[model samples]
Target chain A: MPDERSADEHLLAERLIQALNLEHLAVGELSPTAALFGHESGGLGLDSIDALEIALMVQKHYGVTLRSEDPDTIAALTSLRSLSAYVLAQRKQ
Target chain B: MPDRAHVINLCAGRLAFMLGFVAAGLRGQTTLLPHSLAARQLEAIRAAYPDCHVLDDSCKSDLQWQDSPRNASLDVDEQATAAILFTSGSTGVPQPHPCTWGSLAALGRLDAQRLTGSRQMNLVVTVPSQHMYGLQTSVLLQLFGDCSVHDGKPFFPADVAAALRAVPAPRALITTPHHLRSCLDAGVALPPLDMVLSATAPLAAELAEKAELLWQTTLLEIYGSTEAGTIGTRRTTSGEPWQLLPGARLDCTADGAVYHASHLPAPLALTDVLDPVSSGSFRLVGRAADQVKIAGKRASLAELNRLLLQVPGVIDGVVFVPENGSRTAALVVAPHLAAAQIVGELAQSMDPAFLPRPVVLLERLPRNELGKLTHTALQEAIR
Candidate 1:
């Protein structure tokens, strides 16, 4: 199930990068667990500003709203896998 | 509270930030404004001020407020240390710049008169409160002037619009050139606004004009630095030169220029060399240190950056001179345009010798809270 979730997140992240017009990065370059935000950029090299657009894209595609002030936002937006799991759980609710 | 608190951490929402700012002053604590609330950054501030308390949303709840104005009068000493702001270090290390309550107040008075005008506005700030521009324009303006502020540091165009809608008219939007560009790209419907204020970096006049047309409001760009604070402003649509703020004067020296303002206790020398257009107006020549003698043709990294951003398909970009070599290189965020395409277009307008070699196409620049790229970040990116 975890492996399946990982694959799902990887695909979602790839879709996200593409949707955001992040042409500098490719799907293959980033790992499923790569850090999406912060100074220690795992691979994709995103930031606080990038988070806003990504959140909007997430909502548009997945019908999930990610708020910055939410305590779970940091954990959820940590990586593609985390984001995917968070979105999956959020949508179910 | 002791006789004075050397350092006080300020991390909270907009209203808390405002309340904490006033509370700290009353308590004689110099608010330590960190550029970001990152662990390492906060650790550094904590290391500097060991007694620092984390004043986040959780702690803000502990603070008590009165519904009615207090009968007891609290005297505010104008000369007291208000905050010690750290620069984004585009030039070098994030150096501390201490500002007095008087200094901020003086700038606020001018901002209220010039930027806000006669209208009583409700400011919807897109920039973070920790940022100097955000601290002064969005938060301090509301405090000093007859205006109110919305608490959220709204991002995305929709959030920005919603934030604007939350506030009553005549409303003002305080943001950066980068944020404004993003808003324009989103093309989200914004509520009617009285004015728009921009700072942090040089705003292209074309974008400024487009913003005015889209929002149907005046767009004003503020020109200042961490060292000098807000010193000049201009209406970008008219393509007018930046006029010095009231009680501000620039005296050009052989090196750069000396910055003198009534708010500042003493005259401070600025790193940027200015070309005085008139008595109180000047054009930015470039930073004295940003000049590079490439191929015996002098050019400014700032000007090259301006040209890089102007390129079609280029979303965001920066041109920086490598410390190891005389040649220049650019790390551009233009995913649509290839490195060769950017170079080819740049060659048409700029000298061939000054064109960035091996222009690095980046997903995004490592801009700080103020939307500025530090020299260290640029070096790391190139590496």
Candidate 2:
């Protein structure tokens, strides 16, 4: 089951990278487990503004709404894999 | 207000923020509003203002008077220091500017006149209430204007649409050019709006026109900074020349032009070069400082350029703001490094949003006899 979700998360990460206009970052470089928001380095280096941007992108691309005030928002936006899982779950609902 | 209430912290929803603001002021505390909720920034602020207390949605504060222990009256001491908003300092640290309740309330009255002359307005702000612009338009306006503010801070277009829908008519939206662009780009169906207020960055005329057409509402742009509250405004359809708010005068002095508005405590020194028209309108010629704001986060071109030079580069470099844009561009003299390499190195230290895009490698930077790159020289260098 983890293997099946991993492939979809990778594709979702690529799409998000494009949506974010993070051209300086290579798609392969952004790993599934890389920290999204709080980490200073070793990831895509996203900020609060970028979080809104990614949330907007998710809403547009996957029809999944991510609210900043949601208690689970930080966990959902933790990484590419977490965001993908959250989107997948929301879409299923 | 406690004896150590000289410093305070504000981070909450619109209503809570309002209550906290009033409560803190009653106790004679100057609220510290951190633009970024990052732990590091908050920690640094806490260090400076050790007595600071955090306020958020989960705050168990009782808005009702019965449960409240403080007997302080609701009357706002107009002259009391209301808030200290932190801006991205020129030296890469956060700079705090204290704004008085009187100043904010005065600007609110001016904004109410410009936005809704006689009729009341219900505001749904997309920007966080903690921001200076948000604090003024959404929170402070309610102090003087006959306005009811929605409590939610929605960022997404759908959420924004829903927020507007939940609120009453004659509703206005306070948002940034970045959020407005995202809403437009998302193509979400927005509810009918009375008007839209934009600031933080320059709004493109094309996008403004599209938004107005889509919502059939007037779109107004505000030109202001943290130091100075809302000063000037213009409809996007109109070309240039921002009309100074009513009773707000701009006068040229030996030091520079000073801004004296009815709501300000005293005359404020203007840093931007302005050409005042006889009709009380003004055209912005240039800014004295190389400060640029993107997505409401302000950064200095000098600081960014300094960081660019520090990037293990082989040689000289310069960062210049693109014309009529918030994104910055860099011209580096490093021959061995690729654009990606330069950007990657910058990402390590600088914010990804502020990183210079289109990092152009130049043989040399054009400098005059004074070794300062003039505007014409930069234009030629980037070319």
Candidate 3:
């Protein structure tokens, strides 16, 4: 049986990569609960500008406005996995 | 606290509330917020320093605010900025400018008259009153320029329209190049004006030309800094001489960057790169050391780095313009990102001329022991 969660995660990773122009970040490298939101940017080795660009892209693509009001933006943006999940949910709405 | 003096910032409408405390002569931390909320910062003091003798517009009720005289005399001191004025530092660290009573008054009366002829000129500024440019044009210039001012932060095209409606015709719009571009981009119908003043960054002749066609008015570009206040004003498209404001004179250094101030004081060294216009006026080429002229456009390496770091996938980026016939090359560090993807995103907001022509990507950017980029590291990156 196909796992519903895996399908959702793959879809999200693909969407983020395209939207942010991160043509190189393959999907399998990202863990669903990975630390995508906080400051490991220098330590864990991710581009900071890429993160902001992704956030802007998410805001523009999703009808949902990302602002201080939304608590989930920070958590969801922490990693490709989490962002995918949050975006999947936003797509439904 | 004896350490800080209480101030009312009377020009701002919301700031008047603090007047009750400042008028009472209370000495406490008069933390002035950034110019965006100059009025509210003073108003908060009304409640914060009720016991002290304070004064400002916040003290009056809205209905009665009109009747209240805007004038309030302040004792001038060298450390006056420690009490009254505040500004944006751009860098994370923001510092206050020392505005003595004499300096503020000089800025209001003499400075305004010297820059744009006629005392009591109608004033219009989108720059926040908290900023030096905004404060000078809107408030200080009101008292000194002998002019009436229109209050409100005109940010969007709609906001500019509303602000114009509030002020009568024959007004001057004091604004920055950044915001002005956005207004022009919006393609909104604009009011005719006597003049427009551009500051904060160099006003491109192309932008000045666009503004002239749009509004049918002269757009005067100002060249100076927060520390020096506004010293020189020029009409870029008009190719007019940069008229030095009163109490300002120029002294060229070995490098040719102008040093300016009043005759009473020694001329202060300026970072502005200039071409002397007659004896008094000059043209601002760009900041001497921090920028490189690419295709006749001055590009600040610092501002570029700041923008590059903000890109979604860019962990870090550093640019170096080699002196070898102005080779515009930039090196970016993308530990987890691809070089091609990141550079494509950055080129959007940045001017095409300033954008790195041949952007180089690296795994890690080299930095000195002090965490600063050295010339050697820059050369290595370029190679």
Candidate 4:
């Protein structure tokens, strides 16, 4: 399969794997559009603790804070593609 | 419909769970609270109780509702088994402990008197209702203590803050140390709360002090287990011993302690090592060997290691919580399988929170000649 992730998404994916300590998952193996949370979905199967780690990493790396109460923030965290776009957009601001 | 002896209540929402509880109670059936909703655990529960019915949020009843008199009285059998709460035992299997209606009601009333002085309070709980702590504070308290609980189980710091804001005054946040730390780290704005209840694991004095200072509220930590309901409470920041609830007493044994409560059907021998300071208060020393608590969930490290070794292509492995670490870590000597593959296999039987983070693959563990791993050797290997 062709790699669908953009340059920004690829960078964010590497950071996520390192920050979350996902040693088993390679950046190339990660599907950018797949679900980021939930066990049933064919995704990373991360939990709330990982979510906190991701939030803290995003804040430190891109100066972007993801609030759970914000629907936009939750939506942005749905997948790597969306999270990359959200972080890049926030960084540009 | 054929009658069943028990009903597995898997409702995620508080209201739906309460409704399921009441329906099962009215039918004279015991509610089975599984330790987790994981497929493997649920399968074990089903295998044990072949005649039990499973109920969840997606379950719909075809029966039409019939209006009853407003003042109709409901009779309850206090001696009947109300719920069988499953806790992860040291042996790795989920052990079921039955709670009678009388005991559950008594627990609720005792907790209410001790925590809220029987006052009407709104509760915003972050823990799931399946857990004993969540069931006692959120469901039982509401049923017998005249309190109300928010239906949604709000997770995340911002969501928890929003939930607290949505509720009125005299609100209590029933959560764990992990969740409390997240909320504090996020530094989200929260409304004034009457009290904050922490349980499932020990709360640090510094974190409790920070919460008390920031929220200007009393931060009370509960000491109890699934076997014994709410046993004691203490103001975490005060560095004080836990004050046992009324009608609860501890009898120290050679190994550990035995907990007796008015709500319990029988005395339960506790796995926690305790030091008695007074007649009604005790200081927690530590837990017995093999038990590890992470993110409010308790599991046996020995059992986890056994499960790790049981994974396919896993020749040898050991799971341990690194010194001063929050999550468990593992060192495996599986040359054929990757770290993620081993974790994925273990995830089938274990809770997600207990899964080892940063699983390190090595050629072999630093085991001694007797094939026994020491703490120092394991720590050195992980490092």
Q: Give TM-scores for every candidate, taking all chains together and pairing residue i with residue i.
A: 0.73, 0.85, 0.58, 0.86
Candidate 4 displacement at residue B77 in angstroms: 0.5
DockQ of 3: 0.07
The digit string of per-residue lDDT tens for model 1 on B134-213 reads 88866667766666788788866667888898988888899887678767876668988889998876678888999999
Listed in order, the DockQ scores are 0.18, 0.35, 0.07, 0.46
> What's the candidate order when arranged by decreasing DockQ?
4, 2, 1, 3
Is model 1 an incorrect, acceptable, medium or high docking prediction? incorrect
- Provide i-RMS per model in Å: 8.9, 3.1, 8.8, 2.4
CAPRI docking class of candidate 3: incorrect
Candidate 2 vs candidate 3: which has greater DockQ? 2
**Predicted candidate 2 versus true structure: per-residue lDDT over B1-383, tens digit per residue:** 34565544454577777777776777777888886776556777888888767766654365534433223345668888888888765333667888888877778778878767746788999887778788877776777677778988887676787888889898898898878877887777777898899987767899999999998999999888887877788998778689899888889767777888887778889877878875468887777677767667778787888888888854999888766444677778998887778887886667556876556677888889999888888776665
Native contacts retained per candidate? 0.05, 0.21, 0.02, 0.40
Cα lDDT tens digits for candidate 3, B223-242? 76655667777778977768
Question: In model 2, which regions exceed 4 Å deviation?
Answer: A1-7, A59-74, A88-93, B1-3, B65-73, B253-256, B287-289, B322-326, B331-353, B357-383
Report the error of model 1 at residue B80, Å: 1.5
The residue pairs that clash in candidate 2, if any, are B1-B27
Clashing pairs in 1: none
Measured by DockQ, the strongest candidate is: 4
